[model samples]
Target chain A: MSGKSLDNRRVQKFHWMSRFLSGWAIFRQSFLGKIGLTLLALFALMALCSFIPPLVDPMYQPMAGVDPEISTVTGPSTRHWLGTDFMGRDLLSQLLAGARVAFMVGVSAAFMSVFLGTAIGMIAGYMGKFADTLLMRLADIIMVMPALVVLLMLAALFGQLSIWFIVFFIALFRWPGVSRVIRAQTLSLKHRPFIEAARVAGASHLRIIFRHITPNVLPLSFLYMTFQVTSAIIIEAALAFLGFGDPRTISWGMMLQWVWKTGHMFNAPYWLLPPGICISLITLSFYMLGRAMDEVLDPRLRKEGQTD
Target chain B: MGNGKQTILELDRIVKRYRTKGFFFGAHGQDVIALNEVFIKILRGEIFGLVGESGSGKTTAGRLIVRLEQPDQGKIYLDGRDITGLKGKASKDYSRRVQMIFQDPYQSLNPLLSVFDTISEPLIIHKIGNAEAREDSVWQAMKSVGLSPPHDFAHRYPHQLSGGQRQRVAIAHAMVLKPEFVVADEPTSMLDASMSAQIFNILLEMRRRLKVTFLFITHSLAAARYLCDRIAVMYKGNLMEIGPAEEVLRNPKHPYTQALMDALPKFVHSGGVKRYETLLQAEREVSGYVGCPFFVRCKVARAPKCSREKPPLKKLDDSHSVACFYAEPGIKTRSGGKA
Candidate 1:
């Protein structure tokens, strides 16, 4: 209210802004963070660019006929920048479309699983009698079961799995693991004085969970989500390579599956290499980002920030 | 009756018991009678200190008043209106009117929240002011609590502040709400001597400025002597003595009060002992007992019926009362309650 206090307020405003910006500034300074951000931006660009569509037929729709005279095999021509498949399908188009599919599967799977798991965990942790017993026991059962085997069995039972089906089942199985982790975290957080403080502040049960408890658990969510992006992408790739991916979708794993089935893997190295490299680079980027973020969120991991 | 003090808060015979897990995997462990038939009236603009040893239920009494834990029985009246069984908005409004400064500022505050956010959150929750007004309010609160310049301390986390500073922040949080009634539970036990004095001074200043009625809970009699207008000594969930602070300290009546006075480390001619008592007698489990909860260790319990029957809180004079049967030793008659 006073002139001096007003001046201090303005100074505080600037300080608060800087503290907000510091998270990004600190993250950008890290070596792994730079690479991770660059890789993410690059793939995101690829995924976005695929939507615009190029002038030429990058993927040879009818497989270009097996005859050598027609359009059987071609190296990197002006039309197909990456090259052509043994069946003469354009490798560049496959790569572009594959980026879109991987992005969709990865983001959707991670988002859904994390959202569902956080909800389950918050409820189970905060409201701990029957809800905890029921939800946690269910999580335990799902966690104990072999995830890949279950995914495969479900894929086979459905017969030619759809994109949504894969996303649904992958998220369903994945959430149990996240729920258990978050439940353990929420159990501890619910007892903290801050939670009781919120209760005293007139917060409803929903508000306490969503506002008070959830924000405290947000760092874990971000950390889990980053690793989950990698896991979801890998799981999608694994499903596709095992011939369980949606037949209509042309993912990186489907490209590899084609290369393996055709027996010309060594003879035509270009077809085999691009998808494998993209998968590794994307997953590696996510892993690096996750690790970098771990250091940022939990300052104890950073050497300079370490203090009692 | 002629003290002209208006009662701001009153508890009418409240009882609370917590059932802990029994040892050896039994279905029932030792149940703790946190408070039993505890009654006290806090007057307006006065510091009423609830002094007791550990496990004496002083904290629980404070907590009951704050409605952090509800009493299993009895009524709580604020401003002579029974605010018992308040739910939803009523409960929140009660919180707004009556705030608590918890014992440990370290664990009481949320680590992720800045000091500004911590103090301003109550304002935001209550929807008291807009952003700019809140900034000003927060600045004023910080200044009042002696974390002056406000800007330096406002943006800092709990870890960055010292123990004394953290307690100041906690005090600011309650002060921002402008609650008329504040229950400060050992607000300075964690701080050093000078720091504790500084905190006590801030509390004293707040009381003078705002006419805030405080129920100060502490085990240290020194703190009671320093700040409280009135004092109540508790033992094993029962109130032993209640009176004007100076009168009770000078001319104590209850056996428990005398024991506490004797136990004071010879520094009583001054304001208080240099340190808090290191050896509080190990509390005996007093649940399911009929007599005085203090009977197990009462050095002056002369009556043959001391262990067999409970004594009533009887008045000896205008401003003093004790729960001892032999307060007037010449009269050997049982007053009111049956064994």
Candidate 2:
């Protein structure tokens, strides 16, 4: 006769990992998650090809487009494709390199924001009192700051920062909104009857937060992540456009900076239009994907479509 | 009253209070006494009914017994072990022995969990068996609660089921572990009259087969009469009367109990006039050595002593207990007579 509970082993079997796997499954089935992953996959393929010389472009040799001598500076042509900038760089090749940078910045910054926001928000929402007030007020302070000014200050202080540095820096401003939403969710979710049920069942605080609250907020974090990626890309573009871009790496915003500085605004529609359109499409894809993911994940977060 | 018949669960001087937000900053928050010096002993294999009005603390007392909420000043003993101080593993082990069925079926069962998952959750939480064995027990539990062809209902979420089916799922969840004592907090109050009756029968069957002791909390005395062996009537957080269900309903002692019986609508043409008594200022006045909580609305209240002293739960017979100073068993109840 074992002097132990028959149910103890069974209860312990319910690990947090099982729920996380289930959450990923649910997100995968979502329409936005599907399209978002697909678009991201395509970008990832392009980014991977960017490392190879011949793979990026068959006609132009590696670093050939950068020189002002190899290609003629002209408006949209059949030979040059998206024509050439004042520096004689291929706008199409520069755009491809920009996509790689966009993907990196967007993804890394979004990951940082979501991870910090979730941790901060979950703690504030679950802990209550002093911790709650402290974190929420911190978020409030960050949320009210002007995004452009903060980026400008950072860029001026640390000239030509690496892509990862910009990613982490931008993420600092990005976390407040996510934290606010997640904290609000944790507040409301904590009061749910099931949460009470779990507590009464002798579930530890950490167990309830990770097993219950975490899964519930995951879809929300994911939906926010998509929007975060979109904003991250735009923010990076804006920084690059303002001449804070790294000289070593080329991006859509860097191309726009070149276009503006060269005084080829009206003359080179080929140079100007490509980067702007790419930026719009990338942002649009994320927003569309986010909305669709929300619709599938949580109906409460789902915004009514135009048809409604 | 057999020698071997054990008391499965007992509450001694249980007091629960909630602090309301203060009117001003740094102001002392007012405490709402949800239960006051309450004591109960639920015998093994018996459906002990706790009947009262909406704000009478029936649910609070139920929650306290199962350790859902800690009592401000009291001790909860399960099978003669003081379990209120239990922590971590010991507390979880205690949870295995004492389970609860909440009032709202829709809110009780997690929306994301399927019928099978909801029923199996307790077993899963308690670490009962392997997956195959757990599934076997789950199907048996579901069948016992009348969820036939368990396979068809296993994958269906709570939103897909009817009110009765959902409550059945809730019942299956509570009884799956075969707990020694279960506190059912108004299990059928949320359902329609017909559905409520079916749910009650299922509860009765589970009680019969499992021999599980129950602290049944409900506002409806009629449901209590149909299910309980002994009934405890409460009012404004005070136990008004406790006796055999048939005796309490057939011949009520407390005036509040009489008022409750009088309020029941009867279609028969009988000229039995009902008297109304304005309950003395007992509404929301929680703290203080304040008199009887029901004195303000008591129909048979006389002297001001009731307003000055809180009545203690006193035993009148081997099986009967009343908390009122003026409660006399011989007195004929005006309403609920021969109808």
Best by DockQ: 1
Per-residue lDDT over A189-268 for candidate 1, one digit per residue giving the tens place of the 0 to 100 score:
88776676666655678867776788788778867888887888988898898888888988998888888877767877
Q: B-chain TM-score, every candidate?
A: 0.89, 0.91
Q: Model 1 over residues B1-339: C-alpha lDDT tens digits?
A: 236988999999989889898767568977788888988888899999999999999998888887778898889999988877898888889889898888888887888677888898888888887777888899989999999888788778788899999999999998898889999999998889999999999999999998899999999988899999999999989998899888777767776776687687774455553222222265544555578766766645543566678889988877678888777633422322222
Model 2 chain B poorest 10 in a row by lDDT? B276-285
Q: What are the lDDT scores of the predictions, listed in order?
A: 0.81, 0.78
Tell me the lDDT of model 1 at B106. Answer: 82
What is the TM-score of each predicted model, taking all chains together?
A: 0.83, 0.85
User: How displaced is residue A102 in candidate 2, in Å?
Assistant: 2.2
Error of 2 at B200 (Å): 1.8
Which residue window of length 10 is worst by lDDT in model 2 chain A? A1-10
